[model samples]
Target: MSQATELEAPQAPRTRKQRQAAAIAEAASGHVGWMLLKIGLLAIVDAIALYAAFVLYTASEWVVLGVVVVVAILVNWIYFSRRHVPAKYLTPGVIFLILFQVFTLLYTGYIGFTNYGTGHNGSKDQAVASLMRSAQERVADSPTYGVTVVEKLGALGLLVTDPEDGDVWVGTDEQPLQKVQGAGMDGDRAVSVDGWTSLSFADVISRSDEVEKLSIPFSDDPNDGTIRTPDGRSGYRYVSTLEYDTAAGTMTDTKTGTVYRDTGVGAFTAENGEQLLPGWQITVGFDNFLRAVTDASIRGPLISVTIWTFVFALISVASTFFLGLLLALVFNNTRMRFRNGYRILLILPYAFPAFLSALVWAGMMNESFGFLNQVFFGGASIPWLTDPTLAKVSVLIVNLWLGFPYMFLVCMGALQGIPSDVNEAAEMDGANPWQIFRSIKLPLLLVTVAPLLISSFAFNFNNFNLIYMLTNGGPRFDDVSIPVGHTDILISMVYKVAFTGQTRDYGLASAFTILIFIVVAAISIISFRKTKALEELN
Candidate 1:
């Protein structure tokens, strides 16, 4: 009576738990939740893909459109079916890799071969439209119409009232003038329309440039002219002063009869060597790359910037690694009290964001009314960020402050992982602390740390944020045509060329980028080979 049966033994508890788990599983399997979740996610993915396809189709990107459509169909098939289980896991990453990495790289390389700059950024049709628009002038004898600037669906339009016939009409850049029946009018001026909102005087003033640029077509044909307004109240007809010969690909000035022919270099040029701008994009084989190396204005600055970049990366790595190793050695001792607390303090710089830390240091280093000038130097005005030499020094100092903690953490881990027996054996062999570190510990440390040091060098090589945020690559070079500075690296120089200048020379910048990529790849390969040699020492 006191003993339990064999069936009700210690295994009964686990059996009961198993039964409960099975019951829960059976109930969960009966629910439609898992199916609904899968369907919902698939629906979202399909919707996004369809939207992208529609945009690509409208843009007439046939090759990319075909690829997208095929990919979308494949994705839907893979996820919905039980087959190709591995494909379901790999599809998302592969698609993202193609779209973001492969597409971007290809597009950039294509741009490098072409004159894809500010004036030569569009297709031939767009260039023609722009040229024609630039040649437009108001007809002196054209009748003025009473107009009210109105907006429909965020597009500017003219709600125009005819003076002679008193007919109300509305037109935009795309739409030809059309009758607006039953429209509210203030004598001769159109006050309101049913579907559009009239812009207030303040709104018109705020959007002055947009209102001035708005050209409402008077008729279906472009030759019929468009009505433009300077004040958004009165409109007058204007016609282009240039006529394009579509059959022969020439633009003729209507008044002067000067013919501009397509030079096959993007611009339409006259025989006397004048060119009409807003040119179409055209490929120029190796011209951009040649310009970077051969052009006198760019070549000299490029050489100086390249040298500075190498020096900066090398010094930054050396300084940070040495300092970090020193601190790590000091704290790694077992006899040292409060080692953990000191380590936490040592890594405090790492805890804060690097960008924010750079900014704070920037303020402190400011020549005027800064923390260092006012407090430490007694308002000495040290010109930390202004002078060329001091600016480079300031960048290095800030980078070391921001960078050393990472090196400290890495070196600390490497030092701790070294075997205690190795250190003890070196001591028994009559080796001093320095001798042990130089011969045994160093070789061992290099085996683990060489790869990381190479990576740190790579990171410092392209360290754009420090150069940009701290100095903005300032103390500008007086002799250069491009915007580069004493502290400017290759990446920053490329940025200034592509974006800061009046002409946004994307092709030249891309060419420079290709050069930079080649340099970095070569360095990484050679350094990695050296790192492999260190690994053999262990």
Candidate 2:
């Protein structure tokens, strides 16, 4: 055949098997059922994201709303598109990682740099409103209005009737009083309003605390008196004790004649160093961090807690690892009788949840009626958890009991991984058992287990449950302003600072959290580098 004719010749048809495979791939790619499922799931996710965006918008959290919009758009683009198959598998995990891990860390870091605590948690507008609401005084000779309490959508409201004009209005703590049409009235008292269910006299009595505190503004202007119900049946007019001058940005106490001016520290301060409560959150560069190290009220307990945290973590890791390694070595022997039973018994502590075990230990160590003092020591009254030095010892002992089995399992696996030939060669060279283990076995075992030890150290550094449950982080420190104790580690201290006391300082707690992360990261990096030397021994 001529070369040009040969080049133009028809190719052989595809084999039946190859054609079948191609058909299957095509069908799989365009399957209606699979496509429908993907569409349904993505639709649900988008719906949720849109709802979240709506909520954020209502709260004026524009930054979070923008992020949600971007993420939802990216999700739709990645899943619907045919390109980036690997990304299709990875997108869910990546999204979760960003939401739970990266976003949380970044938010915490931002809080650490800001005044985001009890008195400084909301916008300035909210703070001003709160100040005006909190500093209210009853207006003398104010005419009382007949009123009835009502509820709508789990929110409480007051329906008031003007005795003279017979005009009825509905109002809530958040919403001002507005005239309502078709209100059900009973002898000049508004019994109910349209679109709101009237609360019965009995129901109103049951929520007396809420009813007494409910204050609804008479008008949009802050200067107007609010309608408040002292007895849930009658409403009275009350005006704020502090008068706010909006243009001048100052609050003047009408009765005392003292003025509080904005000092740019998230609060209005008087000239006498008195600051108002419920101040707004604002960015304060390094103030929380500086307070931790400089403020005497915080610095003393913080320094002591930091030192104890390091010591507790170090001792817990060392004690647990040593005991675990020793037991692992003994049980690893082939001729040991009932070794399986012994191993199971050793792992019993780990099999039970650690927190439950901690509670059990706490009960056993109680000074008043504890097993240790009563049974073991014949009522000696030794304080296992109350005394400072004794409490530290007790924590270490309980942690070792709870933690050793894990390390034992790790060491047992690592021991099996070590080659028998290396030990035999040392034996042939006439080295003693100790020398052989030191030179050949230990170094090799460390190659596998050193990383785990470092992780365990980090875990025990923030071992909050043991400290919190066992001693409640106390023998008690009387001198510190915040709630702190002798046995308090950094994490437990952070917990006390953030949640336990009346004054919750979230900004300070977040700063402590960041410090903890830095400490753990630095230790892990350094230890991992040191473990490289053990890897070389392998």
Candidate 3:
């Protein structure tokens, strides 16, 4: 037998099952996926703990938790991505989502309760609360003036001015303003009674301390001299027995026998002329919410702004999508030239920070000397940031410039992944390009891009930077109380109220924030449902 004949007794070939078994054995030897589950669980626990800590302590817990989450996800992805890549990549992002949400919630809650306003920017809470107490106490000691005086140069030094003296005299607080010995004086030394039109130092000083404590009789007390004002009653006002019950939410003025009930709003007023100013740290349960809902000023402009916001967002998404998709499709053609250069140029807008870009655009659109006005509207200004309609439209224009580049990039990536075979098959059936796009391409494209569309809408809804930077919600609308602007979105309006309003009422602002959150959340939920419906349809 030759060497070749030695292999004549051939062994049975290894089956697919045996090959699979061998591969598994090799994988097990490498300890592949060994720590994947543990790492994932640990990341999840850490993210939860961080969020809880933030809820308890606010902004202080994010650093450690963020680092741990990033490290864990990175390590797990490095090791386990041989099995699952997407879950590992998404782990860190999920943690960020939790952190962002917690921060927003805490911020909204903090702004809702304090008088966070102007001239009171940092004095949002404790500092402003001190003002009311200080004001109340400052008027406690009204000076009772015994005398008034004027100084002279010669032997006759002082002159006394008195209410009792038909012959006026001048004296100091130390010396009573009574009849003085001086018969005549001249020029600067003369304390002339002609200039004194009953407006003496005694009159002004008497009113200095307006606050006083007076005793009131429970009934008709003729025995107590008809319950008159105390002895030194010249310019002082007595405090009637008006009791304020914060718990019961009522104010009772015992003298007037009038009761002022807390209307659950900020104001407390009786059927009578009695009223109370908004005291410090008052938590008017649902007044903030009610004001947002029913305030006539807010209602009128709010409806218009809300409508514009939706319209603006819709237009933004549509224009960006169509334009981006068109650009992406054009770029995807094999015959296209300088593709890399074109891509870089197209993505440049997205590369820059959005706020900076918005500001640049705002300046360029300025009515007085902007390059845009010089080109289009000539010498006169266009009122880009002034008129309500023009400002809204201008906002949309700026937003479109900033937002479309991102959409374009996304569409470019998505367009590359779509197989040519589907298009070819449709073309073979004599389908036109538009028909193929409408029937086959768009449906498939939407499956990938719908989420991005929802995100784009959501982003535009609260796109505070663009609105703030470009127009600052101007020009002012005089119709409203406290001066709100035309293009003011809910967030910008909240900023005005909580951060820049007359009183810096953080409590009111917080209340507005909560309302806005609810509105935004509801909108997001609706969008999500719409997404789900599309997914099901697909």
Candidate 4:
């Protein structure tokens, strides 16, 4: 009987729905911990990526990194979660990524197209914010003077000094100076009551707010004049008090009634046309680009530079490829002795410090004292750095030396990957060495190295370091309106505009930089597409 009872009581019946509901509840309970762990990992990755991107100073790079982090987290969650995740699981991340992409792309593209720059540069909102902040800081930090009372009557006069500095400030009772002092401090402490006719301590305390309104007088008179309060009552006036009108953009002294007005230029002025301030900033849109494009001062020799830039890039790519392929072919044979040693020697150019090597090459290329000119061209000066055409050629030659090792290394690996059967078949079919390479090796190598060649071209297009270190785009273009050089590339031209042009035309430089990006991106995209097509063929 006991055995039968135990067996019958072994289990309580449970419905399939109840078991399923219990499992769902358990899965739901684990979600908090699981979600937190996933989010933590994502945040760590994002922080690391953001820090690295910020260090590199890539504009809009943060936006890309953020999207990658969110996508990574959502994908992980979907794969790991036990409970059925709804489409809403990824909704937040997807919306954020889409918004980030759209905003950053539009912003970068717009900035690329606009003249936004420093000193009246940037978007309209940014400009206004910057201006307002500057104004606020200026107002906050302005110097204040202490008042020294000389006399008081129906009219009042006062002497003030910026005790922090030795500048004397004076004002009259009828009209005070525009400057004010002691914003929140004791008003009486800022003033010394020495000579008085009717004013009492109560009057001084009542006008505590007016302590900031006091100014130093700028009147040329030996005896100080008087100041009247706004209520037609008289009070001591500080000399430096000023009247400023935002509408008129003018500041006037109450005592001398001298007025200074903004010229709608960066400077302030008197009513007379005589310049009151020397430094003034003026906004001129697209003018810098126009000058760069059209002015004979820049244009005449710029024409020569434009041609040389193309020539330089072409020669660099051609020479590097030709020399690199030759080396790769020579070294591709496995039977060749000390192959690793030769590879190392060939790669040494890439391993060396670029700037240090560039300087050495510059010295060696010196026409009179240089190794090449002295050894071959004799002691005759060829002006390698000074002559425009010679400078361009010299730059290309230097770049070829610097750039070939990379291509050689890439080609070496690529050449080895080509199946022996292909080359053998080509040779068997009556192909010469040239034909074997042209048909079999070149085609296969291009499938791998074509993208690299395009990348190299893009890099050389903005090779500021090589250009800067070599000739500094020198032999100045004489006919240009502003100072420009013969060998200046678009990047160098932008640099000159931002730093060396008549005005630090940052807006114009920014606009030009955007144009340069468009050109580079277009070239890169075309090359990338070609590489992709080649890969498909392979």
Best by lDDT: 2
Candidate 4 C-alpha lDDT tens digits along 20-93: 99988886787688777877866775576556655445444666767656665665566456554674466557
The local distance difference test score of model 3 is 0.61
What is the C-alpha local distance difference test score of each model?
A: 0.88, 0.90, 0.61, 0.63
The per-residue C-alpha lDDT of model 1 at residue 102 equals: 91
Candidate 1's residue-wise lDDT over 22-92, tens digit each? 87788568757876887899899889889888889867899988987888799889987858989989998
Clashing pairs in 1: none
lDDT tens digits, residue span 1-538, model 2? 6998989999899999999999779968887899899999999999999999988996689998999999999989999887889999999999899889998999999999998989999988778778888988888988889999999867899999987788988988878899999877787788987789888888998999999999998877677868899888999888998888888888888889999989899998999979887899989989999999999988999999999999999999999999999999999999999999999999999999888998999999999999999999999889999899999899889999999999999999999999888889999999998998788889889999999999999999989988888888889887888899988999999899889888899999999999999999999999999888887787
Candidate 1 regions with alpha-carbon error over 4 angstroms? 1-31, 141-212, 216-236
List ranges where model 4 is wrong by over 4 Å.
1-144, 147-245, 248-292, 298-303, 367-378, 530-537
lDDT of 4 at 362: 84
Candidate 3: where is the Cα deviation over 4 Å? 1-100, 103-133, 136-278, 376-380, 533-538
TM-scores, in order shown? 0.83, 0.87, 0.57, 0.59
Candidate with better TM-score, 1 vs 3: 1
Between candidates 2 and 3, the one scoring higher on TM-score is 2
- Compared with the true structure, the alpha-carbon lDDT of candidate 1 equals 0.88
Candidate 2 TM-score to native? 0.87
